[model samples]
Target: MEVYLVRHTETVCEKGICYGQSDVPIAAPYLEIFESIKKQLPQDAIVYSSPLVRCSQLASYLSNTIIKDDRLMEMNFGNWEMKNWDAISPDEFTPWMNDFVNVSVPNGESFVELYNRVNDFLENDFQHNTSKAVVIVAHAGVIRSILCKISGLPLKDAFNNKVGFGAVIKIVL
Candidate 1:
């Protein structure tokens, strides 16, 4: 299967805000951006998206029937959600900063947990699907996790994939 992992476009939130799983909307002037992204994808592929509005909006525009899955959500930042990163207490993120791959945020999940859940979706839902091509509209973290899983990268180095907003990455499974 050819799976295209597409990150949602920029959000309305300003930089440094931790908006994970917060259902933020896409930035303004998204129509042109969405159009460009649409040009890169297969027109008749099975499409999946996070329930978050940012991703759902893009998915809705790209596919007539988009499958909204909770598994595709960005990592839940827990107490950090919707807070500016600089405003957050440094002490609060110290442990997670030290070992984010293994450490769960306060009331949130670890990268391991996100990886596992995404893996479950891939294993059970995606793998069993019959479509020759699939499109996944989700967050950077989810796209990075999928890239790491498919490319044999360590969770700690997931950032290396550089999943820019509205970017499309196609991988075969």
Candidate 2:
């Protein structure tokens, strides 16, 4: 299967805000970016998206019908859901920053947890599909997790994948 992992465009929230799984809206004037993204995708494919609006918005533009899967949602930030990075207590943030892969936020999950769900999605849902192509519209974390799973990238080096907003990564699975 050909998996097109697409990160949703920028969100309306300002920088420094941790809005994971918050259902935030994408930045305005998304049509241009959406169109550019569309051009690179196969016209005929089953589209999947995180239930969040940001991903759903882009998925809708790409296909009339889309499958919204909770497993594709971004990592949960728990108590830090909508808090600004700077506002978070350094004492509380230091441990997670040092070991984000295994450390879950106050009430949120860690990268390990995120990777589990994404891997499950791939193994159970995506792998079972016989479609010619698959487009998944999700967040940076979700996309990165998928990349790491398929490309054998270390969890610590996930940032090296360069999952910019609206970026699309194609991988064979």
Candidate 3:
């Protein structure tokens, strides 16, 4: 199977904001970008997306019937929702910084947790689907987790991967 993993377009949130799993809007005039990415997709690809508007907007361009999946959502940040990364106290982020390779956020999910969800999705697709190509519209964290799964990279390296708005990574499984 061929998979096209796509990150959502630029969001309304400003830079440095921690927006995982947050329901945020995409910036206006993103139609051009969406159309451009849509053109790159295989015509018969099944499109799936996180329920968040940021991802939904982009997914809608490729297919009106976007399969919304909670499993594809970003890692939940809970109380850290909408807060800037710098605004979080060092104590709040320090533990994660040190142990995020395994540790989860308070009242939230971890990279490993997100990976399990993504893996389940992959398993279902890999086992039951016959489509030669599929498109997944998701968050940077979700995309990173899948890439880590495919590349055998550690969660710490997920922080260093750059998955930009409208970027698409192809994987053959």
Candidate 4:
């Protein structure tokens, strides 16, 4: 199976803000980026997207028959959503920064929890459709989770993958 993992384009949020799973809008002038991303994917690929507007908009542009899945959503930042990184209390943030894979946010999930969600989607929804190419439009975290799963990278080292905004990565499974 050919999987095209695409991160949504930049969001309207300013830098330093954490908007995980917040349904933030994409930045302006995104049509051109979407077009470019579309061209890199298989034309007949099955399209899947996170329910967030950022991913949904790009997925809709790529294909009419889009399947929105909650599992594809970004990591849940809980109380940290929409807050500046510096604004979060260091006591709370430091622990997560030190061990994000195991430490769950105040009301959000841990990296390992997010990894499990992505794994469930791949095991239940994706693996069954291995005959056709798949285009997954999602957030950077979701894309990274998929990449980590396929590459067998440790969850703690997931950030090493460097999934840039609007980047499209193809992998054979």
Candidate 5:
């Protein structure tokens, strides 16, 4: 099976802000970027996207039929959503930074939780249809989790996979 993982274009949030699962809008002038991304994908492939507006906007532009999945959403930052990273007290942020894979945010999920849900989506929703190509429009975390699962990379090292905004990666499963 061929899978195309596409990260949404840049969001309106500033660099220091944590907008995880906040339903932020994409930056302006995204049509051109969407066009570029579309050129790299198969128009006939089944398309799935995060329910977030950022991913949904791009996915809709690429395909008329888009399946929105919550599993494709980014990590839920809970209380940290929309807050500047620096503003999060070191006391709370340091622990998560030290072991994000295992540490959950105040009211949010740990990276492992996100990975588990993403894995479930793959096993239950994706794996059954292996004959056709799949296009997944999602967040960086979701894309990284899929990459880690396919490559047998440890979840802790998922950051090593640099998923830039609007980046499209193709993988054969």
Candidate 6:
């Protein structure tokens, strides 16, 4: 099976905001980016998207044959949702970063938790499908989890990887 991990288009958040799982909408004029990405997809491929509006809006462009799955949603930042990163002091974020593999944000999920959810989806999909290309339109964190699972990378290094908006990454298994 081949998996195409596609990040959603740019969002309205300013550079420092932590908008994970906030259901924020994509920025305006994303149609051109969406069009360019749409051209890269397999014509007969099955598309899946996170339930978030940013992902949903882009996925809707190819709604005729796409499925929305909550499993693909980004990791919840809990109380940090919608807050500027600068507002959260290093004291708060540093500890979590130091032990992020198992630590959860206040009222939010840990990286391990996100891994389980994404793994469940991948396991189920791989078991039930064969010989077809699959495209998942989701967030940066979700894509990072998939890469971590496949590449056996440490959770801390997830941030080091860049999953730009509208970027496409293909994984084969």
Candidate that would win on lDDT:
5
lDDT of 6 by residue, 1-173 (tens): 78788999889989989998998888998888988998887767778999899998888885576788899999989999999987887877998878886899889989989989999998885434557788889999999988988898987788776899899998886
lDDT of 5 by residue, 21-139 (tens): 99999999999999999999987989999999999999999999999999999999988999999999999899999999999999999999999999999988874555668999999
**What would the TM-scores of all predictions be?**
0.97, 0.96, 0.93, 0.97, 0.98, 0.93
Over the full model, what C-alpha lDDT does candidate 3 score relative to the true structure?
Answer: 0.85
Predict model 1's lDDT versus the native. Answer: 0.91
Error of 6 at 148 (Å): 1.3
Residue 74, candidate 4: Cα error in Å is 0.3
TM-score of 5: 0.98
Across 61-97, the per-residue lDDT of candidate 4 in tens digits comes to 9999999999999999999999999999999999999
Q: State residue 65's C-alpha deviation in candidate 1, in Å.
A: 0.6
Clashes per prediction?
A: 0, 0, 0, 0, 0, 0
* Model 1 misplacement above 4 A: 127-131
Lowest lDDT 10-mer window, candidate 6?
A: 125-134
Clashing pairs in 5: none
Question: Each candidate: RMSD to true structure?
Answer: 1.0, 1.0, 1.5, 0.9, 0.9, 1.6
Off by over 4 Å in 3: 125-128
Cα lDDT, all candidates: 0.91, 0.91, 0.85, 0.92, 0.95, 0.86
lDDT per residue for candidate 1 within 1-173, as digits (tens), equals 78888999999998999988998888899999999999999999899999999999999999999998999999999999999888878788888888999999889999999999999899888745576589999999999999999899999999999888889998888
* TM-score for predicted model 3 compared with the true structure: 0.93
lDDT of 1 at 168: 94
